[model samples]
Target: MTDQPAIELNNGVRIPQLGFGTFQVDSDETQRIVETALEAGYRHIDTAAGYYNEDGVGAALKASGLARDDVFLTTKLRNGDQGHDSALAAFEASRKALDVDVVDLYLIHWPTPTRWLAPETWRAFEKLLADGAVRAIGVSNFLPHHLGRLLETAGVTPAVNQFEIHPTHQQPAVQDASRAAGIAVEAYAPIGKGEDLSEEAVEAIAQAHDVSPAQVVIRWHLQQGRIVIPKSATPERIRSNIDVFGFELTTGQLDALTGLERANRLFPNPDEFEASQFRD
Candidate 1:
């Protein structure tokens, strides 16, 4: 098998620059889609307990016959399980569901401030890392203040922050915070859920590169040094998404794409919104 390029996290863990996302992927279809991705050269798989497909992902991993070290697996701690003990138990449940002894990366799904205990949850993530149950620990949908609190309380920086970022919602502040703290930013919903890829600038860049709008967008994420998890159940789109490694985006092209930012967010901003009600 050919080697795929990897991005090194702040903590020295290596992750594939691009990964397949299983958000909203049905449990029944997870195995097949994940298998297709593995066959197509994706070694990294991103899922969450909320996605409810860890078992299927585990089955696909086994079916792929790839060694455990060869595939990078990531799962998240749901909002309901935010306290230290609750987070730890959630981690175990996730490991059981995925049938993996150790997950490559585990994340706090969201910083639901109303819970008023996100900092304590970070402590649990720290314990998970110290115990070697998770190779690295991070957070998802965290704003600058949430990250700051984690840093202040845990004294350990998150290796990565997975959040909603696309051309429409550039999130410059969060990006700056992550960069300053030496934490990598992983972009979820990198395509903006089919929202703004049709902008004239994005179209022009796609035409210049002779790639799909999705590919251009994913490449833009790569160029910005953000890990991109692009979800696709279709085999052709899956293949097209990772084909970005073969091309380069010029600085001018990247600038033009970045200039298209309109502060449009496709997902809810966890900082302003209350996720406590959504907790199960």
Candidate 2:
């Protein structure tokens, strides 16, 4: 625990560089997976209302026997909950679902450009921060333009911007902008959803380091100062994902992985994905 690295946020909050992601994890199995991650020494957990597993996450946390403050819990407001009032309501609902009094980080799940209510949603986030309901606030799947709009109207700059980032789709431009703004960039699907792990370049790097392809990718993210949340339900894979602090990637190996970037986005582009108009 002492050797693990943490990234400091603009607000001075410290987050563990390596986190466990609960995206696509079934609600029924989320508790067991989360427990496994905790047992494996993962203190940060990322989930979302859209994932519909907050309760499961909460159950695992309660059962872990660790103090509430020992863990960093993050969840997001769903797309439908994008307006000021609804966003506020949704935040409370998420808190309730998680069975926690407060969340360490809260985020706008997606920038619903079609609904065009991100600004309103941001206002709700501001209130949450002001009221101490959330210690940090951020956005996910937000583009540069979306972040610009948020900065222009937000009283507090987002502490983090989470998006799909992997060896195949390293968002350099987005990462640059986030760095310039002092906003931490968090990588979701950092292993390329198990697609690029077998690529020649990643495999070669893994061979050089005598580690798994996933370890090489995660190490790449840590070396670049980006926060990574890789998801896995298997006990061995979950344990393996966080075993990256033992080794470091050389500059050449890091550059090779960087060169593998091809802008191959796995998730929908927020700019083009028409956000569902249903407001809950």
Candidate 3:
């Protein structure tokens, strides 16, 4: 219901370009923190089953009195649940935990390429879409090669491909591939885990714009037409993260940020990562 900018999905569904990410937000504190974000005008909330906070997300949404349609909610299937039937069952568990009959978006938390089950997982995603359980479907931390394989048998091209992108980790090849495949590229760690913000280029731009380094970085993402999910549990930070629509980064500044790319990746490589490691 807000005039906030959004991008149309491949299926014609409009998704708010900016979202609040609850990646490491503690489940015990998720309700209060999420309520603050909701009150700060963030309509999009992204949580994964692995985050263990979907119930809190549901509580906050219910307590806010916003209609189910007023907010856009996204949750992902965990890595342990990657097979065909298991993926479908995992989605239902997420839906129940979130207390929502329909999820705005659903994603595979990771490609888990070592398991060799991404294609099969995607098949279940297609079924969820067909059954009207999820408005849109996507994948997180997938590289171009993983997507190339999925495309071979995919009935529906992924609506979005979320990655660990920032001024430092540009991932141009993956971004370009997503664009070419008609999939929206989403920046997961858009601020570069607080490392790139201290760079000379980001600092100079922030001083010129009279905003924080994080805001300048976020603004850069918006200008480039990438969906950004910046996570913060503090009330002030949560509010500041979504208050980025007012400014624009200059072309020179944008290029300067782009030049900061050094192929610095912060998270685990999807191909080598497995869910069992986290479980134990």
Q: What pairs collide in candidate 2?
A: none
- lDDT tens digits by residue: candidate 2, 42-112: 99999999898999999999999999888989999888778999999998889999999999999888887
User: What TM-score does each of the candidates earn?
Assistant: 0.96, 0.97, 0.98
Candidate 1 at 196: error in angstroms? 2.5
**Candidates 2 and 3 compared by TM-score, better number:** 3
Model 1: lDDT equals 0.88
Residue-level lDDT for 203 in candidate 1? 88
In candidate 3, residue 4 scores what lDDT?
90
Estimate every model's Cα lDDT from 0 to 1. 0.88, 0.90, 0.91
Predicted candidate 1 versus true structure: per-residue lDDT over 186-207, tens digit per residue: 9999989977689888888889
Q: lDDT, candidate 1, residue 28?
A: 97
Candidate order (lDDT):
3, 2, 1
Residue-pair clashes, model 3: 0
Ranking by TM-score: 3, 2, 1
